[model samples]
Target chain A: MLKITNLHANIEDKEILKGINLEINPGEVHAIMGPNGSGKSTLSSVIAGKEEYEMTEGEIIFEGGDLTELDPEERSHKGIFLSFQYPVEIPGVSVTNFMKASLNAHRKANGQEDMPANEMLKMIREKSELLEMDRKFLSRSLNQGFSGGEKKRNEIFQMAMLNPKLAILDETDSGLDIDALKIVANGVNKLKSKDNAVLVITHYQRLLDYIVPDFVHVMLDGKIVKSGTKELAYELEERGYDWIKQEQL
Target chain B: MELKDKLISSFLAFEEAFDVDSDIHEVRSNAIKEFESLGFPSKKEEDWKYTSLNTVLKHDYSVFPKKEDALEYRDIKKYLIHDIDTYKLVFIDGIYSSHLSETTHDKIDVCLMSSALSKSKYKPIIDAYFNKIVPKNGLNSLNTAFSKEGAFIHIHKNKLADKPIQIVNFSTGNESALMVQPRNLIVVDENSQAQIIERHQSLTDHPVFTNSVTEIFAGKRAIVDYYKIQNDRASASLIDNTFVEQQEESVCSMHTFSFGGKLTRNNLNFYQRGERCDSTMKGITIIEDKQHVDHNTLVHHIFPNCESHQDYKGIFDENSTGVFNGKVLVEKEAQKINAFQSNNNILLDDKATINSKPQLEIFADDVKCSHGCTIGQLDEESLFYLRARGIPLKEARALLMYAFANNVLESVRIPELKKRITSQIALKLGVSLGFDL
Candidate 1:
């Protein structure tokens, strides 16, 4: 579903992602684990087309299209999703309204008319229930004064609503309690199907236990040096990333 | 002749039509003299530093309309809050349109100032409250000199108004360049409550300048909510002077919504006369093109245990300019006063400008006064967050701006008025979100 070839990226003059390559097939969950400053988040942002990160050299082909030239919203219209690590606090727009605007924009970009209001409400109710979100929570301002758990759940709720072809869960496990982790993982699992793909990026292996991945990749110094299966995540969790660094040296 | 000299010459003809022997005649003569002495405030003055009236004042304005112009009720129907019942005092070219007005005298007096000033029955009310609170300034005196027709509202002691009062002034643009001065007087007796909405609109594209003055007295424990909606044509300009006095435990709140015009300057002042008085001032200004709006407000705490709040937000696009000067004063005798002020502005275009200054003069040791001001672009992180969620950049920017200005709009008590302002804000932002307000 997605392919990256020697992705060379940088923020300003400093190099961040150097010579990285990865591939994920349909319906397969891929996990990318790395230590701090190992370019795990940078890779996800590059895929999502964050403008601040300049790609010096690379090609990202997603679903038979080159995503290198498209902007973030264009990429989103082409079925790319990035769950942000820090959700923005929009003080006046309620979550339901935000979702509606996002959904309509996507539809417009695809040359489709606006979805019916009743259908939109029904989908919101279904997805919000899937994430165990309170009905009242959808009426409050978007992510304004929301707890850590609520923000993470809201991200998954949006992912469920959009149903993107390729979803990049960037640090979705951070700042969430155990119960929230299970709920988010369960929502992701329910949305998984043969037509979509999931790429989980995390620094810890606790999330891997809930949403087990088909493949595990260890990134060090902006390159994925190790690729294995579910057992690899357990091993790394027990031995730590220092062993991988020493082995690479 | 210059516009100032023509106004001086026109004062005589303006006086011959009114009751010259009444008690307000001396007040008018004194005010005309004051206006002659002060002329017009120049840019040299600290308060007028950012907003210059040179361009608007150069027009050879007919001080009064040639004749009372007739307007079809359907043509101007959109300007009124038609969904709800209201006490309307409508004017066309400075003349009260009896056919368009809905005045009452059963429980409260929602009538015209010309009646209150000339009629013997209302003379007592006019004597006790007319021209009592307005400052002796050039523009205010200009309005007082020509204060013949406007809305006059009076609520007796402990009498709550059954409906909101709407004071709307429409200039039909019959003359090439016309100027009108309207004077409004509102008195809420002790323990009474009232809500008022005022608007000034120019129907055509001809040059129209409105110099309006309003005086309000909130008696002990009374409550008053006053709203001013200034959305006029590009050739129109307005200078609004409103003064409010609050007695013991009274509450007075004013909301000014400025959307369109060539130039608009609001000088709103509040004086707390007794203890436990509450004063609130809020405004939202959204203007584009070469439009300009200036809000200068003052709140004076004279007695102990008073509180005041001021929140003003502005969004300027294209070459528009805005100014907010908020002043709060706590006198020596006014102990335990709590005053808060906030002014936030966003410049959508690089050429747009805003001048915000918060002035606090405190002579009391036991007072809590704080002020905050922010002038910047919409946050980049928030923009990216929205855009990444599939919202286009333009829509994202508009949504963020609407959110930024929503706090001030939330205080508008009337839902229909709030919806009107909300839709106006949305139109200004140039985006139609698929959600109700």
Candidate 2:
């Protein structure tokens, strides 16, 4: 479902992602665990077409289409989603309005008519209940004055609403409590299907305990250094990233 | 050079052509003398530093005659409130049109000040409050000396008005530059309460200039809520001056929204004279293209134990410019007075400009007063967050801009007026954010 070859990216002439090559198939879950400066977040941002990162070399292909050439909205219309580390707080727009705009934009790009308001409202209610979000939450401004856990859950709620083909969870577990982690993990698990893929990016194994990965890749200094089963996450948590660095050296 | 001489001679011609009443003639003569002494304020004047009155002074604009042309009411239906009936007062080209105005309430008295001045019952009220609140400055002097006609509204003592009062000012001319000055004096008697909505609109696409002055007096323990909506034509220029005074334990509040105009200036002054009185002032301006909107507010706390609060915000796009100046003063005996003021602005384009100054002068040390101002662009991180959620960049920008300006709009209490202002603001944002509304 996704492929990256020799991905070299920089921000303002400072190299962040040196050389990265990765591939993931449909129905597969891949976990990329790295320390603070390992370019983990940069990878997600570059793939999502953030304007800050300058792609110097290499290309990204999603579902047999060149993803590097698309704008952020085009990438989104092509079913690429990035759960931000810190979700933005848009002051005047209600969550329902934002969700409807996004859904309609995607639907229009996919040659489908706009969703009816009644059906959209019904779908939002069901999803809010599933995510344990209050109905009033949809009426308030988008993420304005929201708690950390609430923002994370709202991100997951939006993901459920959009139902993208490829989901990249970037540091989604950094601010979640135990209960929120479970709820988010449950939402992801419930949405899993044979035709979609999930890439969980984190530095700790705590989130892995809830949504286990089919393959685990340890990333250090902008390159994937090792690949193993889910047990590798537990091993890294026990021994820390230093053991991986020593092995690479 | 010819245009400048023509503009100056035009004012001189108006002085000789019009015949004023004996008592008002003296006032107009004095005002004309004052205006000539000050001439037109240039950039040299500290108060007019950022805004230049050169364009207005250089243009040879014509003054509306006493009975030159008839005016029609075309778009008056859109501003009517459904829930509450109101006494409608209409003014066209600065002249009150009684034929087009209607009033059903018995307690409320609505009449043209020119006509009311002739009546013995309203003479004292007009003499006491007319031109009393505005300072004897060049701008105010020009408005007083050249005003064609105005409205006079008086609420009886201890009367709680069940309906609001609406004042509609319209300007109509074809290809001819016309100047209209409509003055309004409102007095809510002791223990009375009322609401007023003042709307300024233009009928033709011709270049029109409107200089309006409204003075309000909230009597002892009375309450007044006032709103000023300026939706003039794109070719029109407006300079609106509003003065509000409060008596003992009375309350006065004003909300000014500027949506369309070539160049708009709103001067708002609130004076808390009586003890234990309070006042609130809020304003919002949305500018695009070469439009310039300047808002100047002053709140004076003369008596003891009075309070005031002010908040103004502006959103500028294209090559537009906005200016905000807020001043709060606490007198010597005004101890325990609490006043706060803030001015914030957002610039959406690289060339858009904003100049904000929040001034506070306190003679009483025990008073609690604070003032601040901020000018900035949209948050980049917030923009990225919205884009990541599948929202296009343009839509994301519109959402953030709407949120930033919503704080001022939420303070408007009247539902119909609030909705109108909100929709107008939304339309401007849609254009600035590169979205088709």
Give the candidate number with the greatest TM-score.
1
lDDT per residue (tens digit) for residues B358-421 in model 2: 7788898898898888888988877777677667777777777777877777777777777777
Mark the regions of model 1 whose C-alpha exceeds 4 Å error after superposition: none
TM-score of chain B of 2: 0.91
Cα lDDT of all candidates, in order?
0.93, 0.81
Worst 10 residues of 2 chain B by lDDT: B428-437
What's the TM-score of each model vs. the native?
A: 0.98, 0.93
Q: Please identify model 2 stretches exceeding 4 Å from their true place.
A: B1-22, B66-85, B431-437
- Clashing pairs in model 2, backbone N/Cα/C closer than 3 A: none
Instruction: Give residue A232's lDDT in candidate 1 (0 to 100).
Output: 96
Report lDDT (Cα) of residue B62, candidate 1.
92
Q: iRMS of each prediction in angstroms? A: 1.2, 3.4
